[model samples]
Target: MALDRPTPVTFHAPMVLAVGLPPATLSRAGVVLEPSGVALRESNLLDLRSDSAKYRPLVLLVDAELYDFDPEAFDMVAQDVGAKLGVAGSAREAEVTLGQLMAALARKSAFPPPPSSADAKTDKWDFSEVVAAVAAQGGRE
Candidate 1:
């Protein structure tokens, strides 16, 4: 009889797909992102949605000059797709935007919410304080 084996899991790579940026810009962006453990790709505005769905990138850096530059709208789109959006006028700015997003995400996951008082099923023994008080009084006088 053959033993059962577990299936391998498929995890998405840490990626950044810069939308509407030229290949030349992307080449520089790639170099900037090399040490951050994130792979960078360039996708035109036409394929933005499809590429976004496929990559599920941490940051979708966009060239604001390509179209109407509405940061708020892009932010909503990013939030809808579960990623942080970055609009860049230059390659260096894009790098900074990505860095800020990375920092924000790191800070978010580093600290957990304080434990709720109601959820804690404290096993503290009742009358323990009273017992301590009696002992301090030297055998109840």
Candidate 2:
């Protein structure tokens, strides 16, 4: 009697795409694509302070060929929305960059926490002292 071998299971992590490229082009890049609108929706959902943990591994893919592309702004928006951003001129490069980012994220997730310092001190200030300090500065309007 022969034993059956276990089947390989594939895992697909959730991702958000904000690229201007066609779906066909992005699909060819080996990335599981979600609509750019989802990114906007996620942003709004986050603004409402709703739980979006289901949307983990979210990334904003931007086509670097765009005429008015602002990488700095894109990065800021991605950070605000708690998502990663990757910009590439070509689909192949985008795939490579995304893979690298995923690997880096994985490594970061496994990192050990920093050791606590035994000499750390917590400063406790008196409320009356704070009021007196404020009054010395001419007080609030």
Candidate 3:
């Protein structure tokens, strides 16, 4: 996917779209956006290290498109991890901290659908009721 629209954006799937560092330009990283949450490759950790040590602890961003993912699941994970690390007293606190990332995902997903080819070619595809037909096809999720 190009950086602009980032094709194959995996609207219904979780994926890490990009990463940024101060000295280095924003580069794409290979992180699996899973339904349960984001999974980071070992390499991603190394890249993150060049940024800030405080941010070294790898946390992930997640959304509905991710595989088997639910927002509440992450809160549970955060709570468990935080308990082990002796950070917040409960996972509910972690949930409050992750508000920004969660909000961003929600907004991004609300984007309008891309222009379909049907808009330009009348004979090729029909725009009217196309979404309904696709929904009926059942192949689309």
Candidate 4:
């Protein structure tokens, strides 16, 4: 008589793409699974814009202390790869951040983004308009 077992599925994504992180951060994140038994890959910002990404549902982690720490650039990277941003300020923080991102990507999770301010019909001057009206009414009663 024999028993059978299952194997880890080959996820569409390569799991993790770590950028500019300290060497010790990955393991400290304490992510427990290797869904594809595949380890992470190191990357540069330029690679993110390419059409050929290594995986799907990938987690992109970047260090805040990069030589040219530009928030806009990193945001663009995340957009190009259709990924959420995880910026770590230090070695310790990177570990915690890595763990958080890894947890979010696990178990085939699908989290839709929350509504954006663009959904509102209000204009950019709306707040100032309200302020003017309040001032016209003779300050707080």
Candidate 5:
């Protein structure tokens, strides 16, 4: 019996939202700043954690020095939600970081694909065929 391979899950466009930074600055850096300052809310965290795969990768640009922010809380939430946490001391630095983050996100996967059972079943030896072809060509193998 033939086994069906499950379809891969396609996530939506990755989002980069910021807190404590002007929308204009983030826009210049190619990121859309979330208008609300509710980044630490339970509802947002829950949604982020539950629907992480449905949405694109998230990077939250936080200016803790300028705002009444909790770095530990943000880090925990980011980890739980599979999001990246970036901290900037000033608006200028935030812009620079956001730009860098955007560039990194645009790049393709940095890691290799995971091993799977399907890989084990795939044909591994092509040397015999190569040897036969070489012999037919009256060439040394």
Candidate 6:
């Protein structure tokens, strides 16, 4: 769906290690999944497990905004399609995304939808904040 948001969101925190490849960065905004894994960009699901192949797993680290719309059901459909494409992985943390699919979401709109009253106390950081922090720590996005 549309990637507009009030703040930023950190989509994933995967620490993938591979020889000769730069670190991969990933995050999610709305239904858009952006992986800064440019080195492994050429490798798709079918060739994922090969030693010489470069690819990252599709992992979900958050389940909020998209879940307000029943993300599990949406993930089921995604899983089915991924399976057909030889992509294997469990849907953890609950898979969800906006109905309108986009390639990527803007950084400012990365913040997840507002939290519920009970969950509002949880601490959250915007995507740019995290990215800047990571960059300060020698991590590229």
- The TM-scores, one per candidate, come to 0.63, 0.45, 0.22, 0.51, 0.48, 0.20
Q: In the order shown, what is each candidate's alpha-carbon RMSD?
A: 6.8, 13.5, 17.7, 13.1, 9.3, 22.1
State the lDDT of candidate 2 residue by residue for 73-94, as single tens digits.
Answer: 6666667668776666776766
Off by over 4 Å in 5: 1-11, 31-57, 66-68, 109-117, 120-141
Q: Would you list the C-alpha lDDT of every candidate in the order shown?
A: 0.76, 0.56, 0.36, 0.62, 0.56, 0.33
Candidate 3 per-residue C-alpha lDDT over 1-141 given as tens digits, one digit per residue, 9 for 90 to 100: 656764573232332222221111111122112333743222232443232232332343222232133445444543443311112222333343344344666687789768898667655556767876887788755
Measured with C-alpha atoms, the lDDT of residue 16 in candidate 5 is 56
**Model 3 CA lDDT for position 55:** 32
Highest lDDT, which number?
Answer: 1
lDDT at residue 76 of model 2 (Cα atoms): 66
Q: Give me candidate 5's TM-score against the actual structure.
A: 0.48
Q: Model 4, stretches more than 4 Å misplaced?
A: 1-11, 26-38, 105-141
Q: How well is each residue in 1-141 modelled by candidate 1, as lDDT tens digits?
A: 988999888788988878877666666678777876888878876777778888788888888686356666567657767877777777777767877766776798799978898979977766988788779898757
Question: Which of 2 and 6 is ahead in lDDT?
Answer: 2
- Which pairs clash inside model 1? none
Best by TM-score: 1
Q: In lDDT terms, how accurate is model 1?
A: 0.76
lDDT of 4 by residue, 46-66 (tens): 765552255642556777777
Model 1 alpha-carbon drift over 4 Å, by segment = 1-8, 67-73, 102-141
lDDT of 6 by residue, 1-141 (tens): 898878875443322211111122122221123344322123222333452222232332222343344555435533543321111121221122211222233443587877788986767999999988888888543
Q: In candidate 5, where is summed lDDT lowest over 10 consecutive residues?
A: 34-43
- In order of TM-score, best first, we have 1, 4, 5, 2, 3, 6
Worst lDDT run of 10 residues, candidate 2, spans 36-45
Q: RMSD of candidate 6 to the true fold?
A: 22.1
